[model samples]
Target: MMNKGRLYGVGVGPGDPELITLKALRLLRSCPVVAYQSADDKESIARGIVAEYLPGNQIEVQYHLPRALDPYAAQPIYDEVVIPIQEHLAAGRDVVVLCEGDPLFYGSFMYVFTRLSDHFETEVVPGVSSPMGCASALAVPLSYRNDVFSVLPAPLPAEVLEAQLLNADAAVIIKLRRHFTKVRDVLHKLGLASRARYIERGTMANQRVVSLDDMDPSQVPYFSMILVPSKSHL
Candidate 1:
């Protein structure tokens, strides 16, 4: 029987190439096969972050997962990606899946990990998440002295988003593209709008950090996030 190869789910960090962990870089250089999620346009932010480390002649697998919010629509794409990955593992070739942030933190790597772990040896390497990167970019303390931090995905219904924002000590609203208007409305309703700061493409070269009040809401990008500190802390 041939030996099976291992699958490594590696987080390359939020955006900055310097943010990638040394372990992730090492694996990217050494892994025979590299997999990453790209858009229909074939652009991959995760791959761009670690592009410098990818060795020449390395096998690149680009999974063009949809950029939409519907997970149901993404299932078939995930299933398609699994086939090539399985083939690599069966052939005893180690595979490295590039993730934009911490693999399990709202990252598509979780889907791949769950699907492949039962059949293959898998490992995860952690990296700096977007919230951390955004906080650093804004020079704001995320949480301190028993402050509860909430990381909410903006796709949630307005009521749920409002309820969570009301309960949170410090909150980070992620995935703010199409949901930007709704999230901004929820923040305004909670009286937290004035306290919110928006960070777009955190840690990237063209990053933008501004007061949420100044933003148009509808004009924000998918990579944008909002940070709201607790009233007590303000």
Candidate 2:
């Protein structure tokens, strides 16, 4: 008879390897099986961060989960991607799933957890999230007394973006790479452009933190985020 296997959903922090939590590092070192999502690429930030911590010759699995443009076409992705990983856990192998930022926040690990937790003993190890890294890299306070903050993605409708920007004292907009120009225009229209600081690959080797006025959309990467704080509230 074999003991039941447990799953550890590990957050690797934003980009810096040193930011990984002690608990997360421990799991990576002890766990015999490791997994991380690539979506389409072979290399992943989450996987790279923990590679140093993992013991040599450990079984490592990388899932290239589909990122289909249409939700309807992605159902097969869910089935094919998660089923095999679940099987590995059921075989009594401790598995660690690597995620960038907090595992539960906008992370693909959530998808796996939701699918397999009913049968496995699952745990989540929190990491330093991206918003904190971005703010610290910019050397700015995220909020002042009584200031409300909103964190939203760039794909949100322009009208909604406008409303949130108008009301929130401080805001962090993620997923800004493709929508950089539009987001920039909205910030400028609301007279908050000067206060907006864009951080690209925050805390990473090629990290770039600059004012929105100086950024060119073409130069921004998908990992970029913009932090805008209202002057009136600050």
Candidate 3:
């Protein structure tokens, strides 16, 4: 029997195409099969970042995993996408799964990695996470000496969000789509609203960086993030 091909989870960074690691670029170009998560409309942020690196002859696969409020609801979509990936590995054709930010950091690639790792030789190429990218874009330091930095996904309940925000010295709230108002209100109540910054499409060409005070909570994208700097450091 022929040896199975290796699977690579490549993080393409937040939004800047140049932020992609050299190793990731190499793997993307060399791999025969390239896969990325996309909407039903076939749009994928990860694919856009690595588009230049993908060779013309490479077989591109888009898994239409629609954005959802409940993460568990996407399991069925993952199951469907895994079949073709497994087939490629079985055929001894290496597959590169494109991911945004670090593959393991609140990324869809985690779902794929967990399912495929035991069955195939897998490796992860890390990239700059959105929080880090947002920090750079806003010229804010994420943490200072002895400062605790927390990362919170905005999908949690308002009470949970408030509790965590109150305890952390600094925090980043990600997935700030429809939950913008709730996150903003929580920050305001904690007296950290003025200290926070809102960043949309960080490191991208059209990136927007604004103070949380000035931002209108209603009109925010899913790619947005809120950076709450450490009070001690500030």
What tens-digit string does per-residue lDDT give for candidate 1 at 120-159? 9999999899999988988877888888889999989999
lDDT tens per residue, model 3, 153-229: 99899999999988888999998888998888898898888888899999998999877778887779888999998
**Every model's TM-score:** 0.93, 0.93, 0.94
What are the lDDT scores of the predictions, listed in order?
0.88, 0.84, 0.88
Off by over 4 Å in 1: 67-77, 231-234
Which parts of model 3 have CA positions greater than 4 angstroms off?
69-73
For candidate 1, what is the lDDT? 0.88
In candidate 2, residue 122 scores what lDDT?
97
The window of 10 residues in a row where model 2 has the poorest summed lDDT is: 66-75
